[model samples]
Target: MFRFLRGLVLPEAACEEANSSSRYENLFKKLDLNEDGRVDIAELHAGLKALGIPLGKDAEEKIFKTGDSNKDGQLDFKEFMQYLKDHEKKMKLAFRSLDKNNDGKIEASEIVQSLKILGINISEQQAEKILKSIDADGTMTVDWNEWRDHFLFNPATDIEEIIRYWKHSTVLDIGDSLTIPDEFTEEEKKSGQWWRQLLSGGVAGAVSRTGTAPLDRLKVMMQVHGSKSNKMNISSGLKQMVKEGGVRSLWRGNGVNVIKIAPETAIKFWAYEQYKKIFANEDGKIGTVERFVSGSLAGATAQTSIYPMEVLKTRLAVGKTGQYSGMFDCAKKIFKREGLKAFYKGYVPNILGIIPYAGIDLAVYEALKTAWLDHYASDSANPGVFVLLGCGTVSSTCGQLASYPLALIRTRMQAQALLEGAPQLNMVGLFQRIIANEGILGLYRGIGPNFMKVLPAVSISYVVYEKMKQNLGIA
Candidate 1:
């Protein structure tokens, strides 16, 4: 009698298992959008769109070409899985590399060494100061678990959450709650709205450029020469630069950077708005995944158009003493030397980085603003300075961390053109060089000052922009 009942249950169990397996299998199959047993460019695009994951044209091409095995131009289930696995592996490797001693903890020396490798010119004294600020325990070394749990993965202080909050609050009209009136004439559309975007973007561009120019110059300098060299510290570096080339040297790439700013910011904001509108409902609410998808897509789109200028800007910023007199000269020189495509030398990592950086940065900014307005601010129209500062700090920190690796790659590629007799610095060459010279830790240089810089800059920019927009009633 027992055997008979067991037999019946066994068949039912097998059937249930089969059903569950089939469901997962189907889901994996969907990831292969082209149905070619792999996910190709079209398939990846369709699948990401379906899943609300945004992939720019460049990213799609890179992923398809690399992720697909056998050059079949598609990503089979195995290939897709492998790509995900590889990402996880890299993350794990990053964590491991950060944990210098096999003792599973990160020491001050380890962190300092990591920065040194990435071309950041931080003294051991500075690293010690940073560690003391973050480390509450008297422990001289931070453990891997502690580094991850407390520093990298702390939920209360997660950079991703902070960034999302900031983005949510900063946008003029998120979701469908805000609407532009259709009664506006076409001329008004071009002259009024377009002009506002352009002007605002120009302001943003100018502010961002001015705020970052010095630091950008310093960062490129450190990357070109080893960080241990004399011109690594900010004040010392600035002094040396001025001494060598005069005060004007500090603003080496300002011309191009300033010009690029208006269109870059305008396009980025516009793309972000358009992308958000496409995916979100009228109420301005979207699921978490959808927000990520939209933000990433928007970032990729914006970066693609603006990237050439960025390359030129970087080249101008780090070239040998006086490579080109001005932005136009630099552009002409690059065109003549490397052809039109040279302007987009580091296009790959840049696009990939922008997706996450913009998406997370915007999302966090909005979220932080919303939180501040709801809990802390007496009025949404005029949140306190502290509230804005806090929001900016959180949002920028998250955006930088997520995009650090790509930033490293971009800086390397941009500086490559200026390095005499240096081998071409593709992504692979950059990574290998970093690994060989500095070990795995070479990829996160300048992250400390970068974090410090981004927080204040973004925070101030957002607060000012928001106040200006509100005053103008341009939302």
Candidate 2:
């Protein structure tokens, strides 16, 4: 399968210590940015960047650590050659798997078939996009020599690592509970790691929401009752809660919010995968537009499915402690008094808000991650956890800002029936009434509390999510 395997992929004694073929020297020269006899971490990363091969922080770090066997913080030519030789067998096996039909070359169709098996759908054009990166002779496919040469310095030993190195951004948790469901490889799904990931995410989300429940409650209160006549800023809002029901009342509605995380996470994950499968282009590639569409649709599907919980969360958040004993009492009262449809009180605006929020969130996160990589990638592979948290926070905040007006409307509509003498408004009527009565600023009434909770929520979610993933063996 690897008929053109270079001498560099041979035993170290034979390829490096015994010989100086131009091929090995040329490859080493590509990685030796300072023209020294060895390659350092920065040079390795820069060299890979120059090759148009992008890798994530973890992948880049792994390559460097594994290759620098002497603990010297650098790779001499011999170490470089030895590392390549050790990894060549694995890379060769990966190539053979891609070279379906045993043709000794990887074609676009093969790429399509291979990825489909891995649960990723890409079009022929997308597959060619992959090939064009590795295809040197313009043959529209990759031969053994092309494959080996392209990946000789790459740290990925298997197809999966290669996929990870190329398909970035899904790396860090970013602390956004509303993030699109992460893509899982077919192997992970089969091994049952998918559930562990979802569980970790759900636990993280639950912890985060609970930690910020008071702020969330305040935000809901502000959205439902904040007005020109009754100015309920954070200070007054919090003080009112303590006066009415004491400190514990701040977490009045958090139980239901925490309870709904599991189902919502699972639904989103499953729906995202299904939507990707359905919307993929001819080459099994999901384009930017297609991905956004799938993600939005997946988000909507999950939101719609768990919408009852949204109504519950809103109702509980705005209610006084003595008004409803707990989530079950609140739900039972609503079901009996308002009928089945009460659970979907604000379905319209809630669904409408998903597109802009998901789209902006995805776009901003990508831009920030890309910008970070461009400016500081050579300095260090890992951007550090705080950097990731910052990116996620800004992106999610932007999303909330873009969609907050609609969110406020949804919360109000969901809680409206509980308020005496409140106007019953559809999505449009709510918009008109809010603008007319509360002014443009009223639409952002609860935004202070909502934003106030973001940093802590993000920090808690990120920490808990990482710990959970580690405990669950979700590498």
> What tens digits encode model 2's per-residue C-alpha lDDT throughout 298-328?
8889888989998998898888778888888
In candidate 1, stretches whose alpha carbon ends up further than 4 angstroms from where it belongs are 1-198, 227-231, 277-288, 359-385, 455-475
**How many clashing pairs does model 1 include?**
32
RMSD of 1: 23.1
lDDT of 1 at 282: 70
Best-performing candidate as measured by TM-score: 2
Model 2 vs. true fold: TM: 0.71
lDDT tens readout by residue for model 1, 1-475: 2122223222233324335344334545756654556555766567655654444564466555556777877566777656544543444455576566677666668766764432223345545554553443547565433333222211112222212222233322110101111111233355475456445535654665566666667666665554422336666666777887877787787677677655655565566567666877675544445555655665566667877888887888776567687778888999999889888887888777765665566567666655544454331123444665666457656666777777778778877867789798788788888778776556776554555456445644555565555455453
Model 1 residue 229 CA deviation in Å = 6.9
Q: Which segments of model 2 are wrong by more than 4 Å?
A: 1-89, 93-178, 379-384
